[model samples]
Target: MPHAIKLYVRYVDAINRRIGRVVMYMIFAMMGILLYSSITKTFFLPSLWTLETAQFFMVGYFILGGAYSLQLGAHVRMDLLYGSWRDSTKAWVDLFTVLFLIFYLCILLYGGYSSTEYAIQYGERSYSSWRPYMAPIKIIMCIGIFLMLLQAIAEFFKDIAKLRGSEL
Candidate 1:
């Protein structure tokens, strides 16, 4: 690989790793909040904000952790046919799949950006009693899609390296 490409890949790998760690910490924090909320609700009947907070954390967990899941190759895939393919065939299949995902995520990023912008402009709020600002969640959706795009690019290059018998 060229020096610049190698540097780019290294940078992406570092970001992915850091994000993965943050996701782990967020999961733990969410778990703790859920436990606390459950206890409070059971013993003291906590305010609606507790439930809303929990829901918000859950949403954040899923959206923010999506890229980390992809980095770990933990995303769902039907491998019934893919698992049986030869190395070269699998490489081509993976490359095509990555290309498709890139295009799909590009569309999502565009749409998400427009939606978030509109939401922010209108000052949208959640319908729940807490009425938290909805724009942040919409923004999170865009960030998640952007991260997925980055991961897709990394995976594409990794696969290409594998197919070419080069170390990534």
Candidate 2:
């Protein structure tokens, strides 16, 4: 592998790993928020913000951890034919399939960016009583999508390396 490709893979992996580690704690945050909400509802007036806040945390948790999930090969895959392939054959097939992933991620990222821009420009808010500003979550969505796109590209590179009898 070339130096630049290796460096790119290393940097992207490191970044996604760090971000994923941080995002993992969001589950606890969501749990805490729900616990508080349950307590409040049982003893006092229900809080409008707790449910929505917990949902937002969940969205962040899923989105932000995507790249790390991809890096770890945690995502599910169809394995009927894949299980029989040799490593290089797998890499070849992966290189071909990852193009579709890259294309899909690109489209998703573009849509996410446009949505985020509209949210920011219009100061969009949710319909709920709490009516939290939508831009923050939209921005996070775009960021997560962008990171996933980068990770997909990194995987493409890794596949190429594998085909070349090396690993990134």
Candidate 3:
């Protein structure tokens, strides 16, 4: 069971890393497109959809990459108090935080699942002119939450190992 859990954690970590890389590429692509659009607009005529497309990509990149950020511990933190704690105390605090995150992610996963299901059932489309299938994007929210949940679980066990004075 422990081996299986480890394998699952590794798989989630791999997926998170891959998604993070994709998000980086998407960001660069969006920047390039934005710059090109600005140049074209300044010199000749601007493309009608370039700015709008860039906005869409930005939204997708942020939403999809949320889990990757969480996994990498890159998310913002107000750790002034936490930063002063001893190693053992910090480990316990981290364990508690991971448990809290897991609980939150579980709720998000449930809500996102229902939202995605409803969107799919109704064939919901975005309000934008492009009218992209919003369901897929909504579904990505569920996936992100699930990934976060997995990472939280992993962190919980890692903290437990730390509390036991053992390296994970």
Candidate 3: tens digits of C-alpha lDDT, residues 1-168: 367766766787788788877876799889998999999999997787687778777867887787688777788877888778898998888888887888888888889899999999999987766677778778766776776677778778778878988755
lDDT tens digits by residue: candidate 2, 64-157? 9999999998998889998898999989998998899999999998899999999999999999999999999999999999999999999999
Instruction: Estimate the lDDT of model 2.
Output: 0.96
| Each model's total of backbone clashes | 0, 0, 0
* Worst-scoring 10-residue span by lDDT in model 2: 159-168
Model 3, position 46: C-alpha lDDT score:
74
Off by over 4 Å in 2: none
Query: Best candidate per lDDT, number?
Result: 2
Ranked by lDDT, top first: 2, 1, 3
Total backbone clashes of candidate 3, pairs 3 or more residues apart or in separate chains: 0
**Where in model 1 is the C-alpha error above 4 Å?**
none
lDDT of 1 at 119: 94
- TM-scores for the candidates: 0.89, 0.97, 0.82
Candidate ranking under TM-score, highest first, comes to 2, 1, 3
